[model samples]
Target: MHSHPRLPPTALEDCYSDLRTDSPLDDNSMSRLGSEMRHGVTSVSNKPKSADAFFDAWIAHVNETAVYGKESIDPTRSTSYRFIWRSWCKYLASSQEGPNAPYTMANPLLAVPVDVSRFLASGMKGSKPGRAISDVTRRRYYSVLQRIYAFCASQAWMECSPLDTLAQQDIPMAEKHTGSILTPQQWDACTRRYGNPAGNTFEIRDHAILMLLFKLGLRPEEIRALRVQDFQIGIADMPTLRILPRSGPAQERTLPLDDQSAEAIQNWKRVRKDLAVVINTNKALQADFNDDRLRAASDTLFVTRSSMELAKVPLLNLVKAHIERSCSEAGLEMPVRMGPQIVRNTRLIIWLHSGLEVDAVAVMAGLKNRKGFLHLLDYCSESVKQKIQPYRRRDDDPVSVTNMLKE
Candidate 1:
């Protein structure tokens, strides 16, 4: 159907064709996927810089393909893909030997891997101002390029992403550090500062979210996946929130709502119901109504100001900002990463200190076993430490190391 199919497949393609065929992405043939990518697809007779031609095509492909329900990569990711592609184009324009020197290759398939590595290593900036971007950010950029190339390569547009040639070490694995657990008093202060009753609609929802994070130690995904029916108030002895397996590893568990959490959620539900009424009467809000987003948010527990389900980028910003503000107001030193994990970790620590069994806590937290709380072992008293001995990484585990801390 397109010109590029006549071109030869790379050596990797021959070896991995079976794997690609088995991939979920292969269900739609390139022709059936869309016509946008057909622009840069060249036969030997007509040549042009495929990167220039293919870039727009790639954007169209991403827009069309982000279709997985709930698990779908949404507009935030599509915006990011466009940003990275623009940056890549800027690098190409600067790297050419002369003004007329054609950008890299006529076929994007033959683009050099070193150039991609160099762009990442030199062109990006970190949040700390003067520094180059961190490895975690580098991995994100690497992921975007790999996704593009993998899809195009599947369609016979290119050999592989230039990034595939990079060494494993070039893009770092996720950083491994112990999750932080806050002091109980500091945790209580954070709750008071963030979760206190609020008159404002947005603040009421935020307050409810903060209470859940403090009490249940919920993952961000769990918060986003919550539905209206998941909040069981009259159905149970106490109001409870159901934590089900989402796109993450969190197992199914129904956690009883604390008095504060239950009240905050009840308040938020009132505001949420009020908003639906406002949209019908207020012509200004109704003027901008998005039927699709309204349908998506209809049963969702949490939503943005725009009446859409909360997205990944906004969720990160919301959680980070919430923790940072609460910590600052409570006069607690901020953790290096102010994300949901710290809140979850602190809640688990609270359970253990309150005399809950290590195995029981692990099951509640949906972790492998006591080893999931291995990092917290050093914080336990010797009596509590004995209970977790069977789950140690080694006989000389850190629970034993805590013994030496006092001696």
Candidate 2:
């Protein structure tokens, strides 16, 4: 049998206590065990062959947990977690010592806390050397590893998670606010260039997307999830866009649309239909097409020129590309980054400056209450700030001091 060092006496005592109790270990107890076992000593005698099986089981378990027993999960979030885990696994395989040398994958829960810290501090492989990742990204990496370790403990794979020893200070603090909102002039320039009605099919489609994002404050996910049936037009009251609930905290709400936004949607629909028909009728591509593709194209409001479903990432890329094009055409400096959220932020700031009630703005933005919209206040324009200057009394004003002296 391969010999491994025994866990500290404190860890053994806690393990005994855990065995004596019917209740599962809480985070605090697990944290105590983690601190005690930070040296990475373990006595599990499984061979390298069994280690592979354990690794596979651990991965499967993580996938199941993340999906919440559902058939599908969010692709972006799942990919991020998997990437971070694989990076840590590689580090462990290269850095493991003693008899476990190459078998770190077999017992990943035994990773040292200091090693985890080092992995976070080190620059990612494809990134520029010495250019450390952003604090937000490091936090996400730590969060993914912490969750995995906690899961392993729950499944009896480890006595505690080594990640519990990770210090809060090690996770750098992000800036309090980093908001980007376009001015009214910038928005008009962007619309004139990329969203012009005279432009081609792609431009018209992008224009409609930008209108929905800026005018109605719809999120990218909400826009991507939109269907042809969601637009209610030629009604007794007014044309409205029904935002269906997606995978977030926002609820479903139908928003009244102005003439500009309604017209943009109508123009895009005409162009989209023409593209769909051409793709469906082409005999050369018929063999490659399937029923699912046809159904998605017909039911989904937005589609690529090739008639494929337009997912969130591609939709965002389209927005960014058009914004860049618009910036160049208008001779304006392109934003460091632009996305659907920026458009949403710009709209919210506009509403606040327009003197719209916070409650009304929140409802239009699909937020639960006015408080939810407060975070976007940082994007308020200089004009808005100047508008409030009159409310404050100047330090030199004689009325202020004279009234106080008289009293």
Screening candidate 2 with a backbone cut-off below 3 angstroms (N, C-alpha, C), the clashing residue pairs are none
Those runs of model 1 whose alpha carbons end farther than 4 Å from true positions after fitting are: 1-177, 235-237, 247-250, 276-296, 392-407
Per-residue C-alpha lDDT of model 1 across residues 1-407, encoded as one tens digit per residue: 11221223332333333332122224364444354443333331222245655655655554565432212345445666566655665554445432233444323444455555556666554446787677667766666666556555544544344555555445445433356776666576666666446658887888788778777878788888898789987655588888877544547878778777888888888888667543442444355566555544566788767754768777677678877777777788777666787778888888887878877887778675666776777667787677865564421222111121232
lDDT of each residue in 282-359, candidate 2, tens digit only: 443456556565555566787786655677788878778877888878888887668888788887887877877656
Clashing pairs in 1: none
Return the TM-score for candidate 1, rounded to 2 decimals.
Answer: 0.48
- Which 10 consecutive residues of model 1 have the lowest summed lDDT? 395-404
| Worst ten in a row by lDDT for model 2 | 393-402
Give the Å error, residue 311, model 1. Answer: 2.5
For every model shown, what is its TM-score relative to the native structure?
A: 0.48, 0.50
lDDT of 2 at 291: 57
